[model samples]
Target: MYLNSTSPTPESCEAVYPDLASAIRCVREQWCELHGYTEPFCRNGVWWVFPPNGVIPVCIRDVMNSDKGQWVRIGRVSVAILPDGSFAIAPKSTSDRTD
Candidate 1:
């Protein structure tokens, strides 16, 4: 799903899945395998916070506006995850001077 750029609370955003099974499978298979980390999977839209010793909950959102649109937003920033599971956030462009 595409992310809203003006989303208020990106960090606390909850991904709405079509069904419980899909969501659980995603947490068990995709999320864990991709991050090399595991946390308790939630079946009902419950929020989970892993301790410092555990893997941090990383929220990834699909980027749809870029020419090379294969990217995800990580903590209010855009990042490209590589095939090996490593990722790097795109640096803030100088043209973004609206502050």
Candidate 2:
């Protein structure tokens, strides 16, 4: 899946996966590893928030992290992977603690 983000460059980047299920698995695992977040059975046509500053797809955490596209955090933030093999995010509060 790809999410447009302004990082090293303002360009649309993608996290390559064998398939959608693989992509979801990476994201869900990141959620749990980051803070032990439990993911529900992902439903179709739903936006799954990866969260602001949260690593997405999580397949490239070591290489890159938190690559949210387009959407920015106003105060609080969240990211969601749409059913279209794409990603979306919204401004919402998360339990993520700042250090």
TM-score of each: 0.24, 0.31
lDDT (Cα, 0-100) at 11 in candidate 2: 25
Question: Cα lDDT for residue 86, model 2?
Answer: 51
lDDT of 2 by residue, 42-64 (tens): 44544344434555532223323
Q: Cα deviation of 60 in candidate 2 (Å)? A: 22
**What would you estimate as the lDDT of candidate 1?**
0.38
Error of 1 at 13 (Å): 26
Task: Tell me how far the alpha carbon of residue 47 in candidate 1 is from the true structure, in angstroms, after superposition.
Answer: 4.9
Off by more than 4 A, model 2: 1-15, 38-86, 89-99
Give the clashing pairs for model 2.
48-80, 48-81, 49-79, 49-80, 50-79, 51-79
Give the top-scoring candidate (TM-score): 2
Task: Estimate the Cα RMSD of every predicted model relative to the unseen true structure.
Answer: 12.9, 13.8
Report the number of backbone clashes for model 1: 0
lDDT of predicted model 2: 0.40
- Expressed as tens digits, the lDDT of each residue in 25-56 for candidate 1 is 44334444443544544434543334335666
